[model samples]
Target chain A: MLERALSGSQRYWSWLIFLLVLMAIGFACYLYQFKVGLKVTGMSRDVSWGFYIAQFTYLVGVAASGVMVVLPYYFHNYKAFGRIAVLGEFLAIAAVTMCLLFIFVDLGYPKRIMNVVMHPTPNSILFWDMIVLNGYLILNILVGWNVLAAERKGVPYSKWVKTLAYISIPWAFSIHTVTAFLYAGLPGRHFWLTAIMAARFLASAFCSGPALLVLICLIVRKVSRFDPGKEQLRTLGVIITYAMIMNVFFFLLEVFTAFYSGIPGHKHSFIYLFSGLDGYGKLVPWMWTSVGFGILALILLIVPATRKKEDTLAVACAAVIISTWIDKGMGLVVGGFIPNPFEKVFEYWPTTPEILITIGVWATGFFILTILFKIAVSVKEEVAS
Target chain B: MGVSRRKFLKISGLSVLLGLGGKAAFELLAPGSIDAAMEPAPIGEGKRWAMVIDAKKCLEKQEKDGCKECIDICHRIHNVPNFGNPKEEIKWIWKETYEHTFPSRHNDYVSEDVHGKPFILLCNHCTNPPCVRVCPTKATWKRPDGVVMMDQHRCIGCRFCMAGCPYGSRSFNWGDSREAPKELNPDFPTNMEYPTRSKGVVEKCTFCAERLAKGQIPACVEACAKIKVNALHFGDLADEESEVRELLRHHYAIRRKPELGTEPNVFYLI
Candidate 1:
């Protein structure tokens, strides 16, 4: 099956090469960071976490969202998703890979990473996060590869594979929930101390993850002979619509609680993110841009006529991905650190090397995604023939 | 032919599980022996360390002359770097204003004397520290004496402890301390006895645990007493007659973010 990926059109090889160049640039920057310490990044004593952590948070959601397709197809016996279920699993493998890489690049002592395993402290949410994420990745690879291989051979996947798929459904939820606990369980980070954080994370993940899947399915349809099926894509659009609505609704619930309670601690982060607290509003415009895109995505996804059109659906999916990425990946982590524990605002922005290293990780993820998708699509095309 | 492969695997796996479980059961049954074997020896018998800062006396001294004797001595002895940039600054003990130190208690109409008074600040060494709770590697932990201790060598530098600490007490070595500008710190590691930390490790005041082990008080307390300010006091909280306990008994004192249930050992007398 991997041999299929080895032989591809010029476009495929070119794309891989392009990603390789970006990865090299990023690796170089990372080496520089490792030498000079985290000083090369934009983080400070006041804002200890920055871009790498934000990306890790958002990618965890994307990885968890694979359950959206897996659960409906596997548990509910929805036949429409059968065509694209493996695609969801493969996407999860790629996303989780990126999540782990982001964490690696962010560590100050990447060499000592095994200490998390060597001296595991059960009390730490990070300890659990390490367990769940690696577990989820392995589960996805096992289930996704075995199912696709069975499909290529025109046989039912074995019983063990089925059991693993069933286990993966709940494991998907655990990854994001553990990631949320990493933030929500911390004291004094009033912005992230919300009870609804896990719920909000799930809602955004459901929308954004499937939205990315929809766009990928469309691309797969354009470039390959095997279509993922019109009915499958349509059902995913409906899932995106409901999930985006829930994501927005959950955010407004946070807003209402903060303002209604009139607690400065509760309201300060929101104000800083939305309207600038004490004349520091670097993120205000970015927050509004996310809001605008969210509204745009909701309107496009809600209209059945537009959503039925592939072009309009593609636009809406792109909007949802961007909107959720900015909201979670940019705002959530940095906002919590503002007004540092001393009630003084110290803003964070990524430096050049930081941004490059981040890009390198993303490129590495896409490179893996391309090869995995190539193999899966080749199998599908073979089965169709 | 003697044993089927599946049967052999099952038997081997069962034996491994039993071996691990037996050791765990033994440890569970004899907890004290395992604890004694693993843990470092206790620092002092039945001692719970605490600190009391007399803010009123400190503010009077600061008002008369901008004195930072305590900060200078603690930083020097600890090999704390002077980065000269707040973003990269590292400190074991530092200063903050009264209003900023106690944000929840800030009143707009407070007296001019107390409103902006400089308050000496450091690790509260919380009785139930969130940093200890969130350290994935047990790199930062609380000793039995109520002092939150950091093991820099064991830290992976994930900075989760920084987020967990509500007081903002923990500081990561974002850059190498030894590479600090020569002008700011003319003689780096002024006290050769203390270790200069490498980059990418979190550090904070240990209540001068090394000095305490040598039967001396924390450097800040000694520095303040040397100047005749007598604003810093350190003693065993568990001892009713200790100086810290006596100060708390006679004066109204407050700890930062007491509502969070961290139960910080450091208290300030206003």
Candidate 2:
């Protein structure tokens, strides 16, 4: 059974070789980072958190997006998501692993992680965040493995697995919520201190996360013989469309509050992000690009002709994911810190070390995803045969 | 064995019940509640450290030679690095010009704007400090006395405190600050109280906690008193008979950004 599952087209071998080369290059950069301090990265006093935190923020959203599949299948009993349920779970596993790696690399001393545990602070959201992230990862593994094993043996899935599935619906929400709390609880940075931050984060996560999953599913169907069908794709596309609308609405709400209140603390970030401030226009171009791509993706997904076509839908998903990634990950963190606490403009651009380390982490996620998907797809095939 | 529907429901119920019970038991046994209530041992008898700055008197002095004697002494004693190069400067104590220091919009009633006058600013050591509330690692905390402080080793360098501070007094060490001068002060050498800071972590004025531990005034207050400027005053804010309290009552004193509800310990008299 294992041998039959392992057999695939020559493309898998070539893809593996490409990933290995990328991984080796990334490893070399990581070795340099270890030898030196964080000085290798482009982070300075004003912009302390850079690419690592941006990746962490984006991956947490992706990890939470697993709910797009889990909720409909487990709670609503929508059987259309059944084929891709395991895919969502595997994606989560990959995303969470990348999340932890981003955190580990960002820390000055990753060895002292036990200090957080040894002397716990219950009031701190970071402690709760760590707890929920790890717990959610474990839950996915347990549920995904049990279901796959049951399908392989032609037996009923464990009853406990259903309960785990229901728990993960809320657990997925918790991971992103805790990530938001890490920023929202902060006092000084007005850009992050908003009450709607968590909602906005979840909205964006749902939009991008499911869009990415849908695109992957389409590609899988084209390459292989497994088709999830047009109805399932349409349902997922509609979900993505609604989520993107909510994400945009949330962003506009933030802008309205900032300008309406006339608080320099709040309004300054919006101005700095969308427009230029004091000749510091690094974020302006990127932010507008995100906005343009986001609107374009939304239109494509909504239009009947584009949504119906598999190729067009795939492009729309890719566009939405890129747009959301830029808005939440790169532009957001950088824009928040530009006119720093001192009202001084400081900019951050990723250095070679930062870019290489980022690539390494992304490669690591892809590697995990490849192996997990192999197991899931193989088991599904056995069930069919 | 085929699992029955009844058995599945029963198992699910029991597992959830047990999980909640376990969580409750863990909370009761945890050290958090106990340690939080346990207060630190008192520092000095009838002496809670405080600062009283006469803003009107400060305006009378020149910008360069102004009441900055306190700032100079404080930074030097603490081995605070002065990169001199504006791009890489790390200051524990510094001055803020009037426009930067005060809310320019608020003083609508006063026509004559004071531009040249600088306020010698540092951490307010707020009674209800916002920075302490936001720290994820419990690195920055308040002492038994009125002073707020930081533990450098425990700091994760997130710099939330720098953002939390409304005064903009806190600074992050972008580069190693130890390259400034090797000749250490005999009075207060570099240690945990004044440990050498690395790049990325947030730091600010500690109100000379080490000096207060040894039953002496803060370096700034001592230096300002010596220079005969008499602009900067220090005493217990809590005590009615203390110099800080007397000045606050007799003279019109204000705090920076009183609207923010930080309850700043450092008072400014106009």
True A-B contacts kept by model 1: 0.84
Predicted candidate 1 versus true structure: per-residue lDDT over A29-140, tens digit per residue: 9999999999999999999999999999999999999999999999999988988999999999999999999999888888999999999999999999999999999999
DockQ score of each predicted structure, in the order shown: 0.73, 0.21
Model 2 complex DockQ against the native: 0.21
User: Candidate 2 residues B1-270, lDDT tens each?
Assistant: 888999999999999999988867767899466455564433544455678887766666644454567767777666677655444456777776665566533354543435545777889998888888766678788776878888777776656566567676676665556644344333333444556776556678888888876667788878766866677888887689988888888987777776667888888776
TM-score, model 2 to reference: 0.86
Residue A182 deviation, candidate 1, in Å?
0.4
The lDDT of each candidate is 0.93, 0.78
What is each candidate's fraction of native interface contacts (fnat)?
Answer: 0.84, 0.21
Tell me how far the alpha carbon of residue A127 in candidate 1 is from the true structure, in angstroms, after superposition: 0.2
Model 2's chain B yields a TM-score of 0.74
- DockQ category of candidate 2: incorrect
- Candidate 2 runs further than 4 Å off: A1-10, B1-48, B59-68, B82-89, B103-113, B179-194, B198-200
lDDT of 1 at A81: 90
Tell me the lDDT of candidate 2.
0.78
